[model samples]
Target: MKRKLLKFLNRMVLSIVIVVAAIALIVVLFVQFSPQFGGKASKEAIESYKNSKNYKDGVFKNTKDVKLDMSLKDMGKALMGFFKSQPNTKPEHDLPSTKIDSLNIANYKGDTRLVWFGHSTFLLQTQGKTILIDPMLSSVPAPHPTLGSKRFSQELPITIEQLPKIDAVLISHDHYDHLDYESIKALKDKVGHFYMPLGVGAHLLEWKVDKNKITELDWWEETTFNDFKFVCTPAQHFSGRGLSDRAKTLWSSWVIQSKNDNIFFSGDSGYADHFKTIGEKYGPFDFAMIECGQYNEMWPDIHMFPEETVQAGLDVNAKKVMPIHWGAFKLAMHTWTDPVERFIKASKKEKINVIVPKIGDLIYINSLEENEGYKFWFEGLD
Candidate 1:
């Protein structure tokens, strides 16, 4: 009996050692190849970023100035809190079978049609022009395919090859999720122009996107493409895909103004006074697509909470608001359904107009009240 016990113990120890060694090897391999591993921001851009007054004081005066509340212990406690909570009671989403070919761009009329292609990716079509925003078509939101957060659903409503002639590509930042390598590679030879925040053109240049096609804008700067004006507005957030390069690139929200209407795309932002300032500069937006999920108290200054999202929409003077940044990935500790539910409640209280569309549903900003048949996508979840 003693000899049998000794043999079992030896086998268990060997198994443990093998597992540890395999994990260590995988980590080393990943670190060596992943773009997020150690890509450096251009020294010139970094210096310019540091010298900027926006970088010196930060975006949000109240919260951005405060130190982070997160630590290893706090993370551990938050993980424990998640496990202690009850299992998800929300019913699974039985999304309809999406037919990409059936999605006709012409059906949207002269008004802008905004299609949520999961997470931050969106298909924006207006006045016969189609634009893709943060076109991340990859299944995972990491530098490597096997590493990071995977998509909750299949590919978006339409594949890159099937997309209409892209007039322009708008990028808010250069995070792997927002500016995917594979997606950019596919779009490189296809799209005509790319608009991005200042210093973010480095990543695109590295990816071989035409330098002439890329237009980088600083805060409050505006550029015209044909008849549309794209303005880079302030957002309360930092940028960096890796540890060493945080805040090296500027982050921004975009205000797109066409001949007849104005649309606001709150790329990804925390709550801040910039919203009011942006409203004053570009007031009464016809439609506003605001970030409304993947938030937590530990990083409150970098992401807006649910209630704050509504306030942001109001502050931006949006005629109609659509909550985004949720329904794609579980990036925070909150229950997956919390963002939409909270947003609905808050918007109702604030008397704000909101439209909650499904993953592939296209919403026409001008016809929001007319097209009241938008399916309650979060019905079962709530």
Candidate 2:
């Protein structure tokens, strides 16, 4: 009996060793090959960006030291706290079961029309031109198919193959969620131009996007395409897809100015004084689409809380604001609907105009009241 028990214990220990070894091998392989893994920034470009007195004198220098109040461990505890506090709450919405073409894409009549494609992606049509912002039409926001967040929308409003002739593509940064590899490869031959923040163009170039068609701009620098002026403005954010390359490239928000209207696209940012500076320089934005989700106290310096999003709108001097970066993925520990609900309440208190459109709904700010209040597409879930 003793001999038999010893043999069984040896087998059990060997099985455990084998399992551990397999897991370590998988992790190492993922780290080595994932696009989310490290890719070096151009040394020349990095030095130039870092040495720029304009950027040095700007808000980035001071905000780098702002420590987060929470950490990953704290986030895990917060998640438990949230679950305990809201025991009856279901975090995910029962996404509306609707066909892709059920909603019609409206033609903009002088005013801008925006179609939310989930997360930070949008289809913007104005002045007879169409622009795609961060065209991340993929099902996952990570390099591997099984590793990242999945879409909340039951179906994409329009598939990449069904897109109209895209005039230009604007990318805020090179994170996997925003600058997806599959989407870029698919749209490579279709888009007319690619506008990105400095050092981001390197990724596009690596992906075979035409160098001449790619325009990289620093903060406050402006470029013109098809009569529209795009200014790469500062945002309180960092960039990296891997552990090693954090802050190697710049992230930004954009101010798009046309002949008669202006729009601000807060690509992704944390709370900072740069918003006020942007408003002072480019005040009275007709409509602003700002990030309002995927926030946690752990990284509040790079992602704003819900109340801060409202303040960001006011800081940018926007006439009307739409909350974005939510309703798509569960990147943080908060309830899925927390960002929108908090934004709605805070906007009302702040007297800020907030437009909450459905996944495929097109919102025209000039005639927003004519359209009914934003229907809570996620209503029936919890």
Best by TM-score: 2
In model 2, the clashing pairs are: none
* Number of clashes found in candidate 1: 0
| C-alpha TM-score for every candidate | 0.84, 0.85
Q: Which digits, one per residue and each the tens of the lDDT, describe model 1 over residues 1-382?
A: 9999999999999999999999989777776676443344476766666555565532212224644447998789767754565444222553332545534753444677777887788888887788889898888778776656466676578787777567899999877768888888887887989999877888887777778998988888899998899999988877776544566677889999998789999988889999999999998899888998888777888789989999999999998888888777656677777888898888888888888888887677777792253356666653
Residue pairs with backbone overlap in model 1: none
Taking the tens digit of each residue's C-alpha lDDT, what string does model 2 give over 149-261? 57776578788877756889999987887888889878988889999887787777777788888888888899898789999998877776765555656788999888868
Looking at model 2, how many pairs of residues clash?
0
Model 2 scores a C-alpha lDDT of 0.78
**TM-score of candidate 1 relative to the true fold:** 0.84
| Model 1 misplaced stretches (Cα beyond 4 Å) | 1-29, 35-39, 47-51, 56-69, 78-86, 89-97, 102-109, 370-374
